[model samples]
Target: MDELKIPNVVCKIEVYAAVNPSEDPDKVRLAVSHVILETDYQYKEGSIKATSNQLNSLVKIQETIKKHRTNKIYRRQMRFNTKGDTTWFYLNKQAAFVDVIAACEEAEESAMGPIKVILHSKDLDKVVDWLAPEMTE
Candidate 1:
């Protein structure tokens, strides 16, 4: 008999500055704060970045995009220059972290743009399982 092992999923959280530079600084700061708090992503003046392999952090990233109304890119498809096994999904942005985790438990497809999740399609199931283990109600 053979045993299967789940390999670690590597995903990156890439946040591009979608807002116009002329946009209100306070709003932008507030928006960026949510991202920073949730993902602990370092903020850049124009566009910022971060990466995480942790499931909870990833869930936090998605929820931030969904909840931040000033987040212009929320629920929009990621503008990846290319696509392959990797599917960059944006959470339509929130319900609850657990709810999103639960949805990931079932659906292969995710909402478009913000809450940007860049991952390989091959890794989707593995990533979801890693994020949310099956639970009994």
Candidate 2:
């Protein structure tokens, strides 16, 4: 698989279980959960989920929270794109985030369609905010 450099200031990423109907109409949907952020700081090990929309917003949010690191140092919850057909996870470490993104990119390049990531983030509050509404059963 080819490794691509992560664009600096990515701040947040939202992975979606994307389905290419042209490649395989029968396999039109998959859960692409695992969006994350890349920070210079360290965090506990865990998991969380989020949406592409929320993930995209973090780039701006990061600017706001950059000076308030102490208050913003945890993972956020998972959310579905308002489109709601896909899922995502957010992260803060490039090394850890790369493994999954690389694999997915490879799969797509090789025409393997969509895939899912099951890892969680280290920040509990963020996880709760993302998953709470759906997990309330």
Instruction: Please give the distance, in angstroms, between residue 107's alpha carbon in candidate 2 and its true position after superposition.
Output: 7.0
TM-score, predicted candidate 2 vs. hidden true structure: 0.20
Weakest ten-residue segment in model 1 by summed lDDT: 101-110
Per-residue lDDT tens digits for candidate 1, residues 57-112, read: 55554444334432233222332322655545433223322233212221224232
Instruction: List ranges where model 2 is wrong by over 4 Å.
Output: 1-10, 22-30, 34-108, 114-137
Candidate 2 yields a Cα-based lDDT of 0.30
Instruction: Show where candidate 1 strays beyond 4 Å.
Output: 1-8, 24-26, 32-45, 61-82, 91-115, 120-122, 128-137
- List CA RMSD, all candidates: 9.9, 16.0
Model 1 residue 116 CA deviation in Å: 3.6
Compute the lDDT of residue 70 as modeled in candidate 2.
23
lDDT of 2 by residue, 15-107 (tens): 333333333322222112222333222111221233332333333333333333322222222333122232333322222223232222233
Q: List the residue pairs that clash in candidate 1.
A: 66-93, 75-112, 76-112, 76-113, 77-113
What TM-score would candidate 1 get against the native? 0.40
Worst 10 residues of 2 by lDDT: 39-48
Highest TM-score: give the candidate number: 1
